[model samples]
Target: MDMNTTPVLQLTGICKRFAGIVALNNVALSVRAGEVMALIGENGAGKSTLVKTLTGIYRPDEGTIELAGQPVRFANAQDAMQAGVTAVHQETVMFDELTVAENIYVGRQPCRGASGRIDWSKIEAEAEKLFERLEVALPVRARVKDLSVAQRHFVEIARALSQDARVVILDEPTASLSQREIRELYRIIRQLRDAGTAVIFISHKFDEIYEVADRYTVLRDGQFIAEGALADITEQELVALMVGRTVKQAYPKADVTPGEVLLSVENLCHPTEFDNVSFELRRGEILGFYGLVGAGRSEVMQALFGLSTQVRGNVRLDGKPVCVTCAADAIKHGIAYVPEDRQHQGAHLTLPILQNITLPILSKVGFFLRGRRAEENKIARHFAEQLELKAAYLTQNVSELSGGNQQKVVLGKWLATNPKVIILDEPTKGIDIGSKAAVHRFIGELVSKGLSVILVSSELPEVMGLADRIVVMHQGRIEHTFNRGEATPEMIVSAASGNELAEDCA
Candidate 1:
């Protein structure tokens, strides 16, 4: 690829505002043909707004957009697609009842003749060709709902290519994918670049940015900060640019002494999810669950939290047997769960921050009685301060907050329950690095105050840095266990990938 070639897409002085908030302020970016440009920033740093503007979901309040040296203005998303710009979002939106081939050629299906009858055979053949070009094996006749998350993403890409897209934007594409799926997606991205399509890869994971992107662009607080080659920049430097300061310790794990067992699971089994998962979480301990995608880590946690009815296990709390059949039962037994899907399961996006925080404790707030607003506000304020949540007011809807702040609200709600044991499944999954550090510090504080926690994460560094003891899961079973001093990235990766379990570690 010629570095001096004209950019396939370019945006200069892009500015967008929503009422009082400035989303993108004079942001600029350019992507050359056959080159991968990484668009990176912290949450609320205007990455999403910029992407929406580029894709014509939001007309920029101010900016000049050019494609191949020609200025263009898109009226809407369809217009952008017609102009050869398309996006594949993180959460794929498709008709679940439609077949894969239909989804690939949904709005612009081929017509047979003057009668305008749909050409099903042509659509299927084109879908197959697209998959073959990307080196993906997927059946065109399969229903969209029946496909895996990775497969759905591939279908989205195929749809984009079928629309004659010259510039392809992928927003957080690997967030839900497994290690293998991520590698395959990377391969497909490289193929697109080789075919001379301008690729914009947006992600928070620095490793992925370094692995797949040829050049990098940084955005901060709705402003373009820098642009440079990936090889010329360091990870620390990139973090500094995104956060406006250096993050010395990404994992702020504190030293705490473990106490007597608080909760114990004995031969816990779920018919199709996980089997014979036994572990003991001690007071003042952060027990980490490490696994790849589909390793049953989240499933076992959900079962322990009484979210699964097919679970068969004996749970003991504080040396006494306990039965938790539902979420209410789990809360009653002093257990709280922060689910992985924060947007759906963790926090109520439509509710105010105060209401979300005080949701689980409504019973104590005198639900039947009036005039409890002060109490609710006080409790919400306390936890919000503890988590360092940034918001204009407690009355602000959670949907208005950034991803990190919303996650904090989720943690706040569970903390307000006053449980002895808390389960956090991918707590820092989508939030930025600064928020991750804050959450890690908060976890350390919780354990220091005699609380026990089950930390389930796919990131190896997170588990290795914060966990006093790490448990590796594979195929719904516990494969290995390691103390903080004994575990290494290599051992955890080996166990997570289905290598032979180490008897000694177990």
Candidate 2:
């Protein structure tokens, strides 16, 4: 990979404004061929907007994009793809019913000479060649819906290569991949770089950025902060640039002793999702659930929250047996769940912050309010302050907030219910380092106030740092449980991958 060559893609003085809110202001980025540039930023740091601008999804209010030493303006995503610039997003947008080969050449398939009919054999051959180049194997005739997440990503990459793309953008590609799959993706990225493809890698994990990226570009609050060789800076320094300040402790675990058991589950079974899942959440304790992508961590939590059907379990709250058959039942039993997919399940994006916060408690507060607007405001304001929520006003919609602030609103909404037990599934999955710190502190505060927490996270470090007890799940069953100070990343990951360790059984 050559660093001295002329950049294959460059952006200068890029600015994008939405409804008078500046998303990107004079941001600049340069990506030379045969190099991987890490785009580092927190949630709402203009990374998504910049990606949209680069891909022609959103035209910048002011900027110039240069590809191969020539100015280029993309009228739409198709235009950008034709210009040899393509992006593989985190959640792949592919036709589920289409075959892998068909998806690769869906828009522009090779036609038979003279006849001008679609050449299916040529399409499959070309798709095969693309996967061969990437050193990955897949059945070209397999339907996309039958493929795994990693396979879907490979298909997207194959599509990029099919278009003869010189600049490829990968946005959080490894967020859902397993350890082995991630390693494979890393190898493919290096392959693209060695082939002189300029790659822009976007991720929230610093370790991944440092491991795969040759150079670093930092964006904060819609502006470029710095750009340099990754070797010249430390992770702490990079984090400081992204958040505009140093995060001394990413996980500030408070000292809280576990009290008597607050909630206990015995033989919780979700039939297909999970089975025989049993755990106890003590008052003032954070019980962590660690697992790989399909380890049934979230499934178990959903069942506990009464969001799953045909779930058979004996649940006891505060020493008394309880039955929770629905979400309302869970809420009535003092259980609140903040789901992982905040956008779809956890938050009502179209609703105002005030309404979203007080939604669950509307019955308790009188649904109509009856001129109790001040009381509604009072409730919303109290939790907002507690969560340190960042919003212009309570009337503002949740859709207007950043990922971190939106998660805060969800937290505030559930906290408003005053539940004795809260289930936070992947609470800080996509937020930045600063927002993660804030959330970790809040979790600590929750425990200190005698609130029991069930933290379902795929991040090993987070679970180990914040959990009093870590439960490892694999293949829809509990593999092992580790008390705090006794669990290591190796042990947790090993158990998560279904390779239970003998030494950690205790």
- Per residue, candidate 2 scores C-alpha lDDT tens digits across 422-446 of 9999999877787888899999999
Cα-lDDT of candidate 1? 0.92
What TM-scores do the predictions have? 0.96, 0.92
lDDT of each: 0.92, 0.90
Total clashing pairs in model 1:
0
- Ten-residue stretch with the least lDDT total in model 2: 497-506
Best candidate per TM-score, number? 1
Output the TM-score of candidate 2: 0.92
| Cα displacement (Å) at residue 345, model 2 | 2.7
Worst 10 residues of 1 by lDDT: 497-506
Runs off by more than 4 Å, candidate 1: 366-369, 498-501, 504-506
